[model samples]
Target: MALQNNEKFDIKIVYDKFEAALHEEDDIHLQFYLESFEELNKFFTLMGTVFGFVSKDLKAKMDILNEFLKDSNKSENFITVKKMIEYEKQNELLNKKGYTSGSRTLLRLHRGLDFIQLFLKKLGDLRDEESTSSACREAYDQTLAKHHPFVIRNGAKVAIYTLPTREILLKKVCGELDNIQKAMNLLPETLEVTAVVHTRIEKLYTVHDLHRLP
Candidate 1:
């Protein structure tokens, strides 16, 4: 990567914040730390965003993965890395819509964005326009327990996810095992996953890679 101009920039500030998030000494302290890192008072500003709208930390994480795959450069490696970025972006978009991570709850429920909002507004404004809303349309159903991550969460990440990459493909057959393990952490100590998961084995499978996870 190419370095920017000699104008001015401090790398330590971000480094400190990243380190702090990993080892949250105190809840209050962590709040202050994250804010401190973001506030202009604590760090410099730039014309462009430090991170993109989706998954601000992706580029940095990509760098790490790149180093790990430096010698390999296999297509699978790139596919895995690309899918990870896409997942992060999708999650970032979800966050923008006010969905909190790590939790399996919806605050705003089903909110139609500006496009739909504008259309409805225009319909109401028209002299002879009629509009109907199927807000009751359920985006989820019984499959939610397995497919929709909201019904079940795994530490701020989707218990299951879909992507067209080798990594996600692997995650599918493994039942997103890592996240499954984490989700298990949320279960009652006495409850067993095998008892319920097996009954819900009809997970949709169109493609092999992200089929089960999706």
Candidate 2:
């Protein structure tokens, strides 16, 4: 999609949808968001374009889950994150290798989301142009890097070096200089809300897993 006003990144829309999807703890409400995965994928692709190497694995994981959800026989049992986890467990769908279950796939994406949230938070908090790469690097190292292979981590560091300058990031996210401070201030709160949602979903998964254990 073409950038609006030649400056359209607008991560806020993605953040809004993510928040809404998280709030949908009810199966029916979660289904509504799942049905809109196409729109979400578009945003994901846009983010991948901006960040380059950071998003391909996430996109792949999303595709896997989306395909699984499209299966009529299996989709019904996966209306919510909790339900999806249960379905995977009950069906013995998760594997130790190759073709990991949708629940695990989504867990990977959740981890990536945490990294993205941190990166955006850092980007928003920046006060100078020179610090952009360092901010992204710091966020990546603190979050995603812990789980990533050494090669992947090194590649991500290289990608961070190529990130757009602070002015560009601010303009893309906030539209104009006047809006920057307001947008920046919102990032921390947004991260907090998303973290809560992620933790809740994770707890649900853990509880379900425990119930299934011998």
lDDT of 1 by residue, 1-214 (tens): 2224432223333334433433222111222223223421111122122112112232333334334335354323222322322443455532445532211111111011112122223323333222122111121122222332452323212211211232332233223456434423432321222112211211211121322221
For this target, which candidate reaches the highest lDDT against the unseen true structure? 2
Model 2 clash pairs? Answer: none
- lDDT values for all models: 0.26, 0.62
Query: Candidate 2: where is the Cα deviation over 4 Å?
Result: 1-7, 23-50, 96-100, 128-130, 172-182, 185-189, 208-214
- TM-score of each model, in listed order: 0.18, 0.74
Task: For candidate 2, write residues 161-183 as lDDT tens digits.
Answer: 87677776565555567666665
Candidate 1 clashes between residue pairs 3 or more apart in a chain or in different chains: 102-156, 169-209
Worst 10 residues of 2 by lDDT: 26-35
